[model samples]
Target: MPRADTPGTEAAPGGRLRWWTELPLILLVYACYSAGRLLVRGDVADAVDHGLAILRVEKALHLNAEHPLNRLFTHEPWLGVPADFWYASLHYLVTPLVLVWLFRSRAVRYRAARTWLMTSTFIGLIGFTLLPTCPPRLLDAGHGFVDTMAHYSSWGWWGGEASAPRGLGGMTNQYAAMPSLHVGWALWCGVMLWRFGGTRATRVAGVLYPLVTTIVVMGTANHYFLDAVAGAAAMGAGLLLTPYVLRCARWGRTRAVARFGPAAGAFTRRLTGPGSPVAGPVTGPVAGPVAGPVVGPVVSGGCETSAGERFPRQRDERPRSGAEPDASPADTGDGAPAPAR
Candidate 1:
């Protein structure tokens, strides 16, 4: 058997070490979602009205729902379904997965990244509370799209007059549909996972998730093509803002490190000066007593008697810039003083 400290096992302490690393953020995320769902909990009537307005604009011009992307959710199995299970259940898995990636990867910022993920979800939920609208399926009185969620009653959960809920236990939101948060959250999770997941399987999971979620939402009748677009907009905004947030955080960290102080400049000393760690092996301006020809003071040198006291000096015999430059040959000037030859 392999030791506990082996590579895949105990050898490394993952981000799992944090108490919230594996599960707490998930609860917090769901709590925010549940709160949004609560505020918008009511008859599906208003949602239906809002979604119809969207259809009006689409039909007003000759250029609308016939567009496959818009009708992507309007087709047979596509028109009448709900990917709510995919949307809801995925919440449990993606949270932990993000934690594992943060622990493994070096390029990521753990605390700030987590903050962004949760903040984006909260923002989406807020949109839900403020602009609740029913999806395409409930629009049977309006358009011809089907309701996949209602059709697959045995598979997942969805609500409204078209189909009843199993119980309040699984209920999330019945009318919040201006933006499809299922799509937004899925996209957010996919991005962070792809950037930070250590294993190949984990990385691939990131790519496939959003694609699958988009299809599931449309197939289930819980969203229109436009809802997915709106979800994507929210997600894109969050991701774009992440770097600026992280940059501020990193700047704060550097200031903190400065205030906390360093190791008395020992590391700094090793990185510079004549006896530096990199001084000998790598070639550079060989700092010494005498200045070399044209290139200033970069050459080999030796010891010499200066006023009877022995001291190291440059060996170049070029001129009276500092001292004798040559190492082997005895350098001297004219028969005269020759500048103390």
Candidate 2:
């Protein structure tokens, strides 16, 4: 048996974690993240204003990293094409690959890591809903930022509108640029690889993956510097909340089992029929020896003895004088004389 406290054996109340169960859960979270982005498409004007506001803040702080990176990628085809692919493809690919790696190799940490990623993704969605900011590429032509993904669209599956396929661009919410989950998920993947990966090469990849992802997002004009910062901060918040989320899940599971366990048992019993072991008690004499002291009358010496009499025929004292003596063993209880012993 796997010990409950063991690292890899730790699981939800339902049962040990299995890939089949975990897959649906992951897909569901992704579905929710995608659906949330589509649902919370805030006003385009407001999104543009938010985007401009972020630019102003970056200028004030002297952190205008996006401009030069965007310019470089735009002017150079080789860099721009690859960076666009990185922005469009790796955000979806690398995160899940890292998750699968953790699930297989570091089972003990997979749950918490998965929770942090999911929690952070939802937080990003909330950011999108509250402050939908336009990506730098979508800003006016005067902003000097180029949409590298659009410029290099002929080389890839994505359309000019965004990362979605040619005609499916409308299905995506392009205004959800405030907190870039692209960067956040990459950071998650990087941390997992750095912590659980035993090799030096894995550690190097861990450090570089998120760093490059941040640059790619900026170079492709998909996210601003502050957006990447917010993404990391969201991941941090998710990490802090992971324990509480797990506790609540366990609590809800316990409550559900307590509420419906007995009814479910009864339903099973009914299905199995009365003859089944779990259905009901036995009706015939039991085969084993009597369990405890018998509590009924015993027949001895032609007289009935009450309960608790261990030796029914034995007496403590002699019979009274002149009264007929107690019958001998050879004599019958009806007063007939007995034969030889």
Candidate 3:
């Protein structure tokens, strides 16, 4: 049997989530989003007009059911308090927990999931900035959209205004409600869990989580039905755009390699150890035979019979085929043939 620590086992923490790596980036992006929303707050008059326009559209479509639903939930403290709590807490809690879970267990999926989430969130932020639609609870008193969180303030730390922390309500952008990120993020969590989860119960919870979130946001009068639809639409757009984003990133890397490959290769060669092509086999001038004439004994035979003598002897030093020994007086010095002229 394979050991638990071996590859593919749960004990092998290969792709485990690195909080130090991901947390700061996630926090930075979210902070920028929050600040950007606040910075782009539209004029109150325009925001109210936009909200009223959405209400009219919903009414025409017979989907302006938020008013009745909000009234019903707020009229009863029992239902309204829990809805308020869900609104304030789950919006911040569930999505992040799901993200952490994905990062840890489903790390291969974490990047795409995170891309869809961040993309959808930024899209929703752009909508909020360009067309700040006020929430139902923020409409004029005659609209009958009770702010359930306000009515149930005593049950939680939320102020009698929006769901911001008791004193931090001023920091929030109340008019940026057109494409509700709450619904969009909830839907992302739901879809990811449904797709990647191992159990039937998990799949069911995945579906229920988003549906319940939709209800909670609507029941609390925090978002219009149309706002929820816009949120879902934003998520769809994100899912569609993520693949192109990844492809562009890959193309960028390929271009970078094409641009810097030669220099990178030279650097790699410099780092290579000895005996590698870059570092081995020196080739240059060395001690070799001098390229000039020779001197000394001129024997009849081509063989010089002397040390350090060059081969393929001089031209006139030829040996005749049927000739007898010379016995000449010059040859008497060593009994060798006379020198060739």
Candidate 4:
């Protein structure tokens, strides 16, 4: 069934989608998530201490489920290898693909959905920076926790460190385990699919994807159960904050238009709009005039004729076919087109 836009709002015109417009922002956020360790590398001993504290709390709450799950997964190579693969792959792949799908399909809600995903990611990044905690696999070997990826290193491209690819383990921040982005992102994808998808199978897949992700992360010893809880909390924060974020953006756009008029508003929209081409000459002002008539959207109070020329609104007329369009009247008093009488 075709979905209708909500009552108070309208989908963008021409059914246009701007998947490319937000690519840079997404990449920037990911780069921050990846490199933010430099700003707040928690003390190793302190991180381990936090990990132990988490275990104690989980025990008190009777929520320390990672141990048994990790044991069950590690005992069987059949389970371990695939869980390792899921840990290594899906965290990076599924989120982006779902984002693209939403951008293409859910025109009305895409902005809110994207905002939620980005907000959650930044929240997780802040958690990693402020409260870095070690995962089960990195705990003392005397503990029963097993790093499934390390155990199955030879079977796949990952090394003995985390599931980072061989020779790149150095880049992996093993201590950034408090709020698991894997679970957070998986949950985001699952939520998007469930909310936007129509079919029962799609909804089932949405539910199963996050459920399996939670199990996989714990089974692989990549996150504590509480870490998953924190991830969900971060996602919750994101969901709560997105509407306000969008409201502020809309208010800012309205203020800009009110202050600077429609031209400023149009320029602002182009800059923020999806896949805006304002960066290049195509959307930039035409210099002086072209030898031929320009025939496109008027810019800066002037009309463009088919012959690639620009003139003020007074010259707004179609040129005769196969004829050169007239040039802007020189600013002389007599030659100017008579006032619109």
Q: Which ten residues in a row have the lowest lDDT in candidate 2?
A: 286-295
The TM-score of predicted model 1 comes to 0.55
lDDT values, one for every candidate: 0.58, 0.82, 0.78, 0.78
Question: Per-residue CA lDDT of candidate 2, range 272-339, in tens?
Answer: 33354322443543221222332334546478666756576776456798888666556577887777
What's the CA error at residue 171 for candidate 4, in Å?
1.2
Predicted candidate 1: what Cα RMSD to the true structure?
11.8
Q: Residue-wise lDDT of candidate 1 within 39-124, one digit each (tens)?
A: 66556677778878876765775434323543554354433343445654675677666655664443225555665666666667
Residues 154-222, model 3: lDDT tens digits? 999999667898999989999988898888988998898899888999899899988888888898998
Higher-TM-score candidate among 2 and 3? 2
Better of 3 and 4 by lDDT: 4
Question: What lDDT score is found at residue 125 in candidate 4?
Answer: 85
Cα lDDT for residue 165, candidate 3: 88
Off by over 4 Å in 3: 1-18, 251-341
Best by lDDT: 2
TM values, all candidates: 0.55, 0.75, 0.70, 0.72
Give residue 181's lDDT in candidate 4 (0 to 100). 82
| Order of candidate numbers by TM-score, starting with the best | 2, 4, 3, 1
